[model samples]
Target chain A: MRIERNGAIAALHGHCRVEDAETLAALLWEGSVTTLDLSGCDSLHGAVVQAILAFQPSVVGSPGDEFLKQHLVPALARRATAD
Target chain B: MIDELLAQFLIEGREQALEAGADLAALQRGPADPARLDRCFRAVHTLKGSADLLGLTPMGRVLHAAEDVLGRLRGGQGEGGDFSVLLEVADQVERWLDDLDTVGVLPESASAASQALIARLAGDGAAPQVAAADDWDGASAFPGRAGVAIRYRPRADGYFAGDDPIAIIKAVPDLAQLRVSLAEPVADPALYDPFRCTLVIEALSTAALPAVETALRLVRDQVALATLRAAEAFAPAGVEVETARRTLRIDAARVDQLADLSDQLVVAKGGLIELAAQAERGGDGQALGQALRAKQAELDRLVAALHTTVGQARMTPLAPLLGRFPRLVREIAATLGKPAALEIEGGEVEVDKAVVDGLFEPLLHLLRNALDHGVERPEARTAAGKPAQALVRLSARTVGDQAVIEVVDDGAGVDPARVRDRAVARGLIDATSAEAMSDAALVDLIFLPGFSTAETVSSVSGRGVGMDAVRAAVTRLGGRVEIDSRPGLGTTVRLALPIRMVLAKLLVVESAGERFGLPLDGVAEIARVPADRIFPIRAGRAFVLRDEVVPLVDLAQALGAEAGPSSDRVVVAGVGGEPVGFAVDAVVERIDAVVRPMAGLLAGARGVSGSTLTADGSVMLVLDLAELLA
Candidate 1:
């Protein structure tokens, strides 16, 4: 789900598609877009990962940003599950 | 192949039979006149013949059934009970006709119903001979045929009904060497129905028109019978005087064209005088044109008088629109379960034939609104110290070129405050705006789209659309809508519509050389203010116009045009009496012409309504006052 200040809103099925991630990156940089909601997305592709890392979003451990944090820290969850 | 045409003929025959039956049913209550009965019998008989000619057994069977019943009624053999049955048959047939009208085909389902009706009428068997007595026997006799020519249009249904139309023509008494022409038949027999009544008879009869009309008794609506004296047609031919007064009947469009020609010729007479004066002064052609100009002016007067008489001949009474309403009121009263009576006055008021067609929908909506909202329920009315029955009055009259139709009802009136409250609730207007609104301004809010004051929505009223829709429809035709309401009394919705909507007078004003028109009524006043006389205030601007302080807005900036130098003066205007001043570059010419609307994207633009051409043949934009004020 994505909600923008300029009245455009989009809902994704599950994980953000690679094409959708690139489009969101372009829209976010336009600055007119004030709101962003990306929940339930699992896989973060390499290009999208690099784009997100380059333009750092103020990510908090909120339900809406949970999916983004999960993709951000893959190793911690991998070790916890092994113990 | 013929079956489809037969079906078509049958459908039309059924429709004609039903219309005649309805007319008969309406005429039955009024003065018992033989002419009305004759009209009824003729419509049914025409349908019957058309059905038979098309060999539409089922359709012929039904019309034949109706014809027998109506024939007996016309002959005074049976009681009025048969009229009720015939009306039902007419209703069923009319329904079938409507289906055919919409889809171009009648469903097979109605055949059984038609058969049932035919069986009932068939059981009656023989029809009594109807009385053929004339109402006004020998009343205005048409003189001899020396200068006269007549034309007859045989019933459109006559050919399909197997009626030998030529025989009907031969039946006309004293008919002289008549030229007959058959109207072309429909092509594509597979799609064409042999039963469909497509035949017409165009005849030039020397007989008198009224006498022929008397002979035409049954098929009057379906027939175009006219008698033109030869002199009338020759009048516009620019021939000799006596020859111009001889007989010939021309179409109405040609008459209007002649009027335009005469007006142009009158102007040409002025030019002729100027030329003749110059010719005489130059000592040239004095003997050639001694009284030519005088003769031309006299000829112009004679032509003008002839044009006036011809135009008057085309003026038909408002009877047709008036005639349909009593029955409409009866039907609507039955449907709504209310005892409402329609009192129509001044129905003799004549209007352009075109205006009558546009009048129906607006009048219908007004009547429906009166029934649904204005008229109170029986018990409620009696409890409120009012009469149990509601009176719905429809009156039409000519006030100049405009016709004013007043639909007045004796019921509860609309409350302006309630309308204001609704506007506030809908968020259509701000709280401060609502508070500042005048009663007239508040009353005008009822015409806003999606505004309804009814407590509960019914199929008839509320539904978030009512008077506003009527206002929009009326205004689209270049008319004005006014509402007068007295709480606890009644509401009268007055529609002042012009005889024709094609042309109007617009006051042209300019802002930065770009011309725009403020519909004359929307412009309250236009004044010139010296650069020192005008003063401006913060937040909202006001200027004195005819002793009243009216708020002003710069037109160029308001319309989002590039800003230019400010002017001290402005055009103060508003719709529905909300005063707002719009500053323009200059006040230009006032023009009268046909307004042509802009297409697509341009039509939706703010502050611009439509465009029209000036006398100099230049386009001027019509300003949208409401949008500018908003």
Candidate 2:
């Protein structure tokens, strides 16, 4: 995986559980997270969506779990790559 | 001081007289027996003596007149047609005594009313023939001569005023013997009117037939005279037989003292038994011989039985306690401006004297509460389509060695919803907790201190003291308070009190490495559990018994005792209906011990009722399970 540091861009990664997604969301709220990839992550459930809404209400994604990779991660990655 | 106690005794005495008089009045519907008539007179005589000591002069005079008239009736006085007046006199004396009981002194009005009743009886002018007629029995007992007897009954009103009927019988010439019989008034002192007399008299006279006729003729309106033939008077006679027939009357205090002394003797006998057992177990030849040779032990056994019999004879019915309620309800109704009827059943149930004495205040509170709060206003009842007059019923009965007193009222019942709202408003219960509670649980909250849902505070009730104090009073005696109410129907409060508190049974258990007793009523079951049966469901949580998850707290951890694990029973029980499981070091055998209340500072401690001395002389603390569970 190729990743950008503090500005939020990241390459594809493996699967993560719903609980891990929640932990990731909490970390993103603290401004330490920039971008992520989930090419192999699988166990993530609606809890990840809940964690996002709970921590960063303004953040959104397309309708399904795929939306997390297509929109959320890329959105962060673009911001990081530009930075 | 003796006089005051005597007055108190008289207060009860007049009541008994009235009850007896009522029986006589009922008997008047038929022929009356002379022995029963004599027994009735003694009851009145006792009333007179006690009343006199208390300086209740008017009441004393009333009873004296009654005693005289009843004497004539026993002497075979004229036809027993005039007993109605004697019953009426008893009714009046009971009323006066009742008045003295309530106001602490009889008012002047009572004396004057009594005088009027006596005057009415005197005007009926019953002859003073009791003593004269009794003379005939005495004279005829001598031989073949026929003797004349006279009887007298005063009027129902003022039977004591200026009427020395007994003195009159004494005045008859040539009288051989005289006896006055008085019967107790049948009126309940609570409902007695102070102007009635209940007396009958009989007199014996032996003179020429003309002389007997002439004496009867002098007070024809006041006395009834009859000629008793010699055979009727002398038929049954013998000194030893008469002595055997007589009952020896003794003081109640003496009987009580004998009973107390007997109890001590029994305890000593038990000690002797222990000593004998020790002698038998050990091959102690001298000790065993001494134990066998003790004749004093046999004497003690006989004395103990005698004392027991004397003590039992002192026991009267619970009627006296139940008797006070009718008058109480009457007074409460008048004060509350409500129409109410109090019905008491099983008044004849017998209870220990000490229990009856302690029951007064608790029963009073229950009755007052029912009257002041439980019953609704007349209009409320009318609107609800119930009887305008509400009914309050008190029933008491003995079950095994326990007495159950039920105070029930058919009136407005307690509303749990209102109680819940009040509790939330008062911050006693949070809204969520209140919502989660059942109606029964919510209603029970009323017994908590300072909890009331009363819309208004009246002098009679609703100042927020609530039933907490009442519950404390009952539990202090190791009794339970149970309340069941249905809105718009009625409420019943049942108090389950031990027949006597001297002896108690408790379950001994070791909690926190210390021996403690859990009252038997609170112990549900004791079960042994394996270590593997317990499992942690949460970080600091575990379940103890079957699948139903019980929050586990180590006895040592919860009570700050030494926590050393060993195989022991996981005692499972519910306090106040909440499931609780606590481990104990061991469950000692059940035992019977006298419940000794904890002393001074420890008396108020939670979860401990008192301490008891075990057979081995070790102190065991009695745990109050309800308080612990709460």
Candidate 3:
């Protein structure tokens, strides 16, 4: 519910949870969402992190939470670069 | 220039490597636990993330492959071979980290090694099956957190059964650090069923175990609970946690600078004491000298405290060095077809970094000797009424100011008769001398150069370096090695090393109008032998000390200096286990000093180990008694 899709870009806001994973995955699977903006996000569930890992989405901006920005963001970004 | 981030990464990378390796070894030992597999996955994932950040593509590739295999194993679809491949990857990553530390770059062959390991891991991942589920008892995953740890793996059909796994965990009291992951790898997002629950959720709560258990009563069968004791919350699975101390990481060079400043302060304080002595000698300055002496006493106490603090700053725990031995022991045992286990104790004991760094090679050699020669074959062990599986214990403990490390094996011990015979055959000693030697003396011959009791040279240990090398390496660190063996029982090799290497007690002596220092530990006794008590020997002067003939060497002549005017003072020191007397002009006062090893042109200087600053700011050479005798 925290994800707003605009064409090829999906902007995530506030705290993202397990419920948001299915929608993110569906959008990623549809070959529409290529870039994710985590600028406003403060926390992420492990499932949401997994979705980003699997789809290898290009990430822009940064998370508000230090752990997410420093640890999770780099981990997620690495997958995209690796692909 | 070394990047601060890169240095931090190296420290963390080594820690994660050890963590992952230990977890993988545990997983390979018995029934599979998904939670344990998940812990291993996270450790590898962290390393890969850091490697990627540092642009270490080769290390990242290997870790990524390892993560995939662990994911599959967590999904109940992995074989036993996958664990070994992952362990190898962990070791390879550790070696790469070491290379990166020394050269600030990975080796050129890292890419090839990574590719080979990835291929092996991929091959092992091809054959998958349902792994048996075992209870996860490790509370180490929730480090520094005390409470009930909940590992909830909801049934795959639980979503249809109206069970919300996330809501169930969220209702627990004082929830903290919730982690969710796929119980199995998502094969394809296109075919993924969103409604089918395939998640493993783990969390910690401050609530009591019973309260948490009651909260998860509806899904009790799927949840595992464990109490994380507060005192040991930060320790690994088997390591004993010492009292927690707040620590800050500082560059080792900065610590050395602080120690050097402290040494200068000590010398200045010594100068003040000497000034007070001069003041007391003046006719009308007795009261002034008393006040000066009082201030000097206070300064002495302060300087002593500062020295102790600086010494503690240089202390590093032995865990980092000792952690890798268990895996090494396992691999060697497998290679030799000898089933053995290594139990390490007192790894938390802290010692000077120099001692810790210097101990690795000698300890590795001793461990190899234990595995290769001391431990008997499985059938041979059984025949001797011992357990089929050999146990090799590597333990460390602090006794007074020394760190005593022992590598012991529960197998056939050294046969002194065999050793004596080997010595005779090798021409190290004559048959008559060998027969006259006691069992203890014969066993000591193993430490002699070119000595090996193994009839055939094995690839594991007998590459020419033996216990003699171990002794030499330890001696360079100002430590000693002792060995004790029983005929049928096993052997114990003890390495008693000084906890602090910076500070030393030296006995100042004057010979030929020049002052020198002798290590106080080496000097057995000092006596004023009469001129008649000493007699001329074939090569040197001989004197009787406690009914034993001790050969005396003139200190000045030994150092190529002119003879001293007086030779009455005899300093008896035990070199190579025999008393040798050094004749000097006079024995000066003993003082605590820091000795810096000879460097530059004097690095290869014989008979002089190091130099220390005297109270008068003069460089006094600290003699190496063993080297002098040799």
What TM-score quantifies how close candidate 3 is to the native fold? 0.38
Tens-digit lDDT string for candidate 3 (A3-51): 7788888899987766777888888888878999888887766556657
**lDDT tens readout by residue for model 1, B1-630:** 344444434444554554464454444333455544655655565555444444445665787677666656655765542343455455555666666557765567667656655644544332210111111111112222221232344444444454444345445555544332223432432243333233333333455544665665555434433233332322222111220111133457767766776776677667677767777687556543665666577667767776665655444556666655665566556666777898999788765544554455567668877887888887888888988888999998889888888999988887888989988897778889889988878888877755777887463434433566577556645567898887778889898876644545577777865878778767777777655656677775677767877777778877788644776657777765778887788776554445667779897877677886553335678878887656
**Candidate 3 per-residue lDDT over residues B1-630, each given as its tens digit:** 136547756776787787787677556543576545755775786687567657799998989888777766765674543365576688778888999999999999889767756765666333211110133432555754666667787877776676767667767776655655557776977898765677776777888654786798787667655455454323333331222122344458767767776777777678777676777677457767676777677777767877776767778888767875776677678878999999999998988876876676678778878988999999999999999899999999999999999999987889999999898999999999888898988998898866888887564665444687677667756677889998779999999988988768788888989889999999998988888999999977898988999998889989888888866898989999888999999887676666889999998898999997653345799999899767
The clash numbers for all candidates, in the given order, read 25, 62, 0
Chain A TM-score by candidate, in order: 0.47, 0.40, 0.89
The DockQ-based order of candidates, best leading, equals: 3, 1, 2
Model 2: residues with Cα > 4 Å off, grouped in runs: A1-83, B1-317, B503-630
Worst 10 residues of 1 chain B by lDDT: B129-138
For candidate 2 chain B, the 10 contiguous residues with the lowest summed lDDT are B238-247
Q: Candidates' TM-scores?
A: 0.38, 0.36, 0.38
Alpha-carbon interface RMSD for all candidates, in angstroms: 41.5, 50.6, 4.9
Q: Write the per-residue lDDT of candidate 2 for residues B482-579, one digit (tens) a residue.
A: 88998898999998876656546676777666888777766667777667777776664456555677755565555445775664566666766765
lDDT values of the candidates?
0.57, 0.60, 0.75
